[model samples]
Target chain A: MKKILLSFFVALAGFAAHAQETTLAPDQNPRYAESRDRYIKAQDQLLVNMNTTVQQTYKAYDWYEAKQERKLQRYNDRRERRLLRAQYGNFYSPYDNNYYSPYRYAPGFRRNGWRRGW
Target chain B: MKSIFLYATAAILLVTTACSRKVTRIDPVDTPDISGKWNNTDSRLTAEELTSQILTEKWIGDYVQAKGKKPVVIVGMVTNKSHEHIEAETFMKDLERSFITSSKIGLVQSGKKREELRAEKADQQTNASVSTMKKFGLENGADFILQGSINSIVDAYKRKKTVTYQVNLELTNIETNEVVWIGEKKIAKNVKN
Candidate 1:
């Protein structure tokens, strides 16, 4: 009876060793397969989110810059015209020939040295 | 026999536990919400566009005040101090466009424009009769020079980040060195994982 019990024990040990040596396929291992799938899905979602954020951020910056550009352009245009008029006198009306022509000033104004008086 | 059974049970439990801990595939339900966070909050403009806008606002106002007189304007070099590579030329162009569109200030091009003008005048003098081509000097200098800088800061963590940008512009009297006007724009962005 003792010998029979020993033989049974050896058999059990051999069976356990054999089972340990066996390798289960990934698909067969439900826990491993599920966890790996979850990780992959998470990675894909993360990528999509990252890409969307980048595009949106770029667009936002672009819009803001464009608006500001328009504003600055308007300001500069007005400023330039003002400066031009100041330098050359208003171009809207014909130049006063008398005011501009050195030879057409008040009669005898240049001859009598009376330019300073005016 | 009892010991063998215990050893077998322990081995199976260990294998199951190890297998259960692995991540193989992701669930569709847990997919990230990319659309929710995706949005264009800030817009960008080319340098020329920006310059035009600035010029239009200040130039028109100044022109109206001067009563159709072209006021002298000196556009100074814009400085870029931001984290990204930015050209101040865009801002300058916006200022120039504003001046040109409004017909308010006499906007002078920088050294480059002046050189080009000089070369053209020289060519006219040599290739064409002096009498036919009018020789004119840039009579108006900038009465006011506009200058400014851009700056920014970024704060970030794992899969999340924040950025802040600032633009500061100033108009100053060239002769007196007095600041007449100051314009500024600030932008901020937040990103999540």
Candidate 2:
């Protein structure tokens, strides 16, 4: 019985040793295969990101152009209004809600169609 | 005589019309792009982008709030890793201009300019008066170094090609070697040759 128990203990030690040896042993993988695959994945992701970023840049440029155009239009509108006011603003009368040229002054001026000086 | 005068007048008119060239002076700020390449537009846009992003970032605010003054910076090496001979100086100058105009940050002289300055000061010590001589070693030491790279990729097929430029700028603390700020601006162009 003692001999039998001793054999059983020896077998258990051998199995444990085999398990450790196998655990520590290197995998029969190719050179940098796992790391290379991971690297390739990352590269692919970066490329994809770059592609999207480039596209976004185009979109951003277009958006900025449109915004600038809108701003210019607004500026032109304000400028046009200013010019119109400078040109014909004096002709307007808030009291009558009307426009009257000095050459064709309002009814207060004497005669039909006031002279240029008037 | 009459025919000669008429011919002479006509010839002179023809020559004048043919020789006269129209020269227009346009605003440099809103200059038009005639060629599909990196140009002033790109530089200006990049400067604006960097200024807007960098100035408003948390790093500048945190530094200012903590230090009670603007952070001093030195423009370091910015390499161009592109197929074309791209000049980083133009945009870098524009960036410095923005920093100065904004008054949110400070910029110090760098590179060949800095060296030239030191040389001039050394000359000043011997040549100029004691009060007029500029002293060295009292220059503002930059707390941060701004360095970056301009990388590009060209994808060409037949008459169509796409140019992508990535301008990556990073501000690092000179003492601690910790990266304080990083800003990236991407500009792309699609050309048909």
Candidate 3:
């Protein structure tokens, strides 16, 4: 009877060792797999969010810069015209005006109309 | 006829001289504010304000204590909602330069620059030798972001005017979305014509 009891205890120890050796995969727990997938998705979403935020920030500044450039160009053109007007008497000045003037192209005057005082 | 020719030649010379643009190359530091607009001098002043106010803020100390490392910073958009045309990029560049020169915090590139960096890294993965290639997921993410706005108020009566430019810059904690610091620099110019 003692031999039979000893054999039974040995068999129980062997069974426990086999069970310990056969470890369950982590995915065996549905919650564990679900949590891992959720974490990965969250990380991916975070990256997208960061990318979008920076891009939008840059886009806003780009628009502002372009607008400022256009404004500056307009101001510079206007200022140049004003300075030209101030330097060369008026729009009727020979060097300043591009419009057709009856006095400039009168009957007796040639190319140098201002010089001959036509 | 001789008298008329001489007068006409003199007038032509004067007009030509007046119309020709003469640009003198002077030191940028010595540039004068002739337009009464936002200029490099104002940008320099803004840099001074940033160094004095933003760097010395209590938030820096608090971040250092909590993180035990220098906080990383990234500069974001600076909107120009002003009366005159203001190039915010130049101002932002000045601010970034100030931050870098101070060495109080770490600065990282944002926007297209950052994308370019990532693309280089991605290219390295396939093209570079295994031993020499750089790995991903090692970027130093910014802890704080700085944003600002340039606002101006102009009061003009006839040819006399006072243009006041108020630059408001704020730094915020990226993770917590809490405003860590706010700095303002106001420059006012009075022009009489």
Off by over 4 Å in 3: A1-118, B1-21
* Candidate numbers sorted by TM-score from highest down: 3, 2, 1
The digit string of per-residue lDDT tens for model 2 on A23-108 reads: 53256444545665787879634333210112111221233345667999999988987676554454346632224443444555
lDDT tens string, model 1, B1-193?
9999999999999999988866667654355545222112222333433454455566447545765565667565555565565555544555566667766567765554655676887788778885776476745666777766666676655456666777677778765577767766677767654
Please give, for residues B140-167, the per-residue lDDT of candidate 3 as tens digits: 8899988878887777665566778898
In TM-score terms, candidate 1 sits at 0.42
- Candidate 3 local lDDT, residue A105: 32
Across residues A1-118, which tens digit of lDDT does each residue of candidate 3 receive? Answer: 9999999999999999988755566546535556667878886444442312221121222333456679999999889977865544347466535333333334345654432222
Worst 10 residues of 2 chain B by lDDT: B152-161
Q: Evaluated with DockQ, which candidate comes out highest?
A: 3
In candidate 1, which residue ranges exceed 4 Å CA deviation? A1-118, B1-68, B134-138
lDDT of residue B25 for candidate 1: 77
TM-score: the better of candidates 1 and 2: 2
